[model samples]
Target: MVTERLSMRNMTKTYGTNTVVKNVNFSVLPGEVHALVGENGAGKSTLLNMLSGVTMATSGEIFVDGEKAVITKPTDARDYGIAMIHQELQNIPELTVFQNMFLGNPKTKGGVFVDKDREAKRAKEILFELDPDIDPWEKIKNLKVSQQQIVEIARALLANAKIIAMDEPTSSLTPQEFDRLAQLISDLAKKGVSVIYVSHKMDELFRVCDRATVMRDGQYIDCVNMKDMTEESIVTMMVGRKIEKVSHHSYVTDRVMLEVENLGRVGTVKPASFKVHAGEVLGISGLVGSGRTELFRLIFGLDKPGLAVAKHTRMSREIAGLDKPANGKVIVKGESIKLNDVHEAIRHGIGLVPEDRKLEGILKSRSININMGMPSMSKYTKGGFIKRGFLRKKSYEIMKGLNLRPLDVDRAIGTLSGGNQQKVIIGRWLASGTEIFLFDEPTRGIDVGAKSEIYDAIEELAKQGKAILVISSEMPEIIRISDRVMVMRDGEIVAQLEGEDINEATIGQYSIGQAKKQTEAVL
Candidate 1:
């Protein structure tokens, strides 16, 4: 007979009068990959927090290999051979990759001085097993978000963790990276390492997890084998309702609301151009580093556009005082405008929901009403005073339309789940009266139910004649909502597909440079 590797019996957590998790039971067997799944705020994070010793459980008993274990701090969890990789990464930005990997536990010489050489060597070996492109000596701040995620995984592996909990680990990874991670998980399981995986993506769960334990409103619902359930069944269990499939119908208009001509940014973005009509959703499809987010930054004026010419040629043109190198032009409503900064972009009726929402969007400590009303403060200002009641009323309306949870505009935006926070961000631009919307990974880290709601909101925006330009790493989302799709690869828009041409196969082919010549024509 085999005892369970880990178990949580009647686990309960309470914050004052609020009980976020109640009588929840979870278990993992050695060599098994168990999925902890639920909608945002379904007590998944709270439970994981308790298991990882981020927070103490008010009531419950934890068992490892049939022996009760006490985990009161992260160090305690580490002592028990458990590691957690949070969706919101916790790496120190200034530290080098190898240093961050061996942060809390470091190799030491003579049990006193730090052994940098040994740490770097081990880090390189682990990173090679994960992603060889990552350099162990590079600062954590310099790596891409995906690379940073890999570093976190490498840290866990370095600890030789018997049980690892990952929260939405693939939210920032590319398809290739995800495949590599899946293989890694399989290999670890074979080595008798149990993994507790938490993700909002159903497909990923089905692909990687051996079994799933579903939670709802802080209560344990059911646990099922992956082979016995389908995606629809699991989603219904998660949200407590059958989700209606979202269908897309073309809403494109003849009036072009936003046009980009030869937008470039030196090494990051090549000369690229496209037009978005009044009522269209133009989906930008690419891998994580395919310049989708960088292109959006240029369009939103967060970064300055650069001349596509060679460095020396650009310098010569600047010296000669020639007409500003015809690098790019942003035309709004047939009027050519220079978007030199974020203010200029907003003034031109353009709003960006940045790729990294936590860093670039939403003020977490502030109330949802404040965050929603930020871009449109002038509309509610009278005599240098904010009209609080009016702003609250307007914010409630937008929140209701988006089906935002809790319905409390005064709640701190940070306390909400990933899906609700995304809703509030989208509501921000809606309140701002933004006409051309740029959404980067809008549905990332959000559940199926929330994704449907966001898609509906985007459709409604298009119906209102707002031109929507979305950058999504998920190809299914692109195929679902986009009226036209732009496939980018290696900093170039390689193909534009509309109507019959915009299937997943075609888009995937273009994204990886595997498409036929007929489809290689650039827009």
Candidate 2:
């Protein structure tokens, strides 16, 4: 058996009253790919953070090669031959690939004078040694997400990492790029490097990992070899119960509230067409970067489609006579108007819950009330004057309805945790009185306990006659909440499943181009 290179026994992490990860015990053996997986907010990120020295384990012991090693910080872990690749890109976007590769550790030509030429040469050699496709002198900001991932792996190898923890590395990678990465991981295993891979995708785990560890709600459940398990069994273990198999949700709406006849963006979401009725949830389920988010952005006026994938036709306006070639009009109710304008969209009762909540959802400097009540300021303020009392009073009402912890209107929103911050943003739109809501990865970065609350709120909104369009990577969420599922691949809406067809395996098959409209499903 390969010897254990790193061990975390009785690992736990806590913030305030919530325990993010608890009593987790695992080992990474040399020359093996150990996949760590669970649902979103099931403590995978916290566990990886503990191992990577980004966060010190609250109460645990870490052993390196059978010796107790101190890893109170990131530098200490690097000293012990441990490295990590974050889920969110960590490289400096302004810096070149070479500069980022040798950021902290640079070659000195004359004791103090830095040798940039030699540093770039060494960086190129490292990248070539691994992938050879990524150029070291190119600016990191100019590269796609896949190329950035390759650069990160090359840097880890250059540091001579014995234990590497990767958090959802393939989330942004294309199929061909993923295949190359899987092979590279195998090659690294052959060289005796232990790889700890974290992901929620089941197919990738079965293909790439030697053994797997399953965690649920911050607790470690089991660690078993890949050969001994199936996807259903692993999911059952991780979730602690069998998820009831449900077909698609049946919708009873005939009122076409939002119509997209030919909606599209060039090289992004194709000319896509779909109709959503009031009180219905339309789910677009696909892998990351499958243009699920891109499609919704166009509908909400966040971006104008360069090309139309689908166009809408109404009784009043001619679809062919539309000025925009990229796509036709996004019609609300009976009138057809251009959806490519920001002010027009919100005025027409449309609200968007963005994917990156930290960057886009809530304002950092604003108060909780301001974050929640800013959507429709006219309702709370007087004519060309301040109306502070009404704003705070209204914001508190929405926060209470959402079950936010403190319901403190005066508190700065940035001080709250991720879950509470998400509530603030949701509450913001809920106050807007929008008829159509587009939510992209609505429950990301929040804890498991909060996810249930968020889902309940979404269900409430749908039941209240809102046309909801949801884009989520997690298949289970799509199945549990959506009234209809639209499977996308390569920026095209390949299949639309109504009642009795939305299964996780079926969605995966469609998203990967494995199963099509004509082909029978393997599962």
lDDT values for all models: 0.88, 0.80
Q: Residue by residue across 315-417, what tens digits does model 1's lDDT show? A: 6544432225666888889988775577788888999987778888989999999999998799999999999999999999999988888999999999988
Off by over 4 Å in 1: 121-150, 307-311, 314-324, 516-523
Candidate 1 residue-wise lDDT at 60: 99
Among all windows of 10 consecutive residues in model 1, the one with the lowest summed lDDT is: 316-325
Best candidate (score: lDDT): 1
Model 1, global lDDT: 0.88
Off by over 4 Å in 2: 11-24, 37-47, 56-59, 212-247, 261-274, 285-294, 304-327, 337-340, 364-370, 380-427, 442-463, 472-523
Model 2 TM-score is 0.76
Which lDDT value does model 2 have at 207? Answer: 93
Q: What is candidate 1's CA lDDT for residue 140?
A: 98
Local accuracy of candidate 2 as per-residue lDDT tens digits, 1-523: 6558988999999998889899999898888899987766678888877877889888998998888988888888888889998878789999899888877777888879878899888888888867687778899999888888888887787788889898878755655678888988998999999999986667788999999998888999899999999887887887677655433334436787888867776667766777888888888888777788888888888898654424444321233223345465688887776767866888888889888887888888889998887768888777866588988888898899999876788999887766788888888888888888898888765544456677778778877788889988777889888888888887778888766687887888988888875232110
- Measured against the true structure, the TM-scores of the candidates, in listed sequence, are 0.93, 0.76
Worst lDDT run of 10 residues, candidate 2, spans 314-323
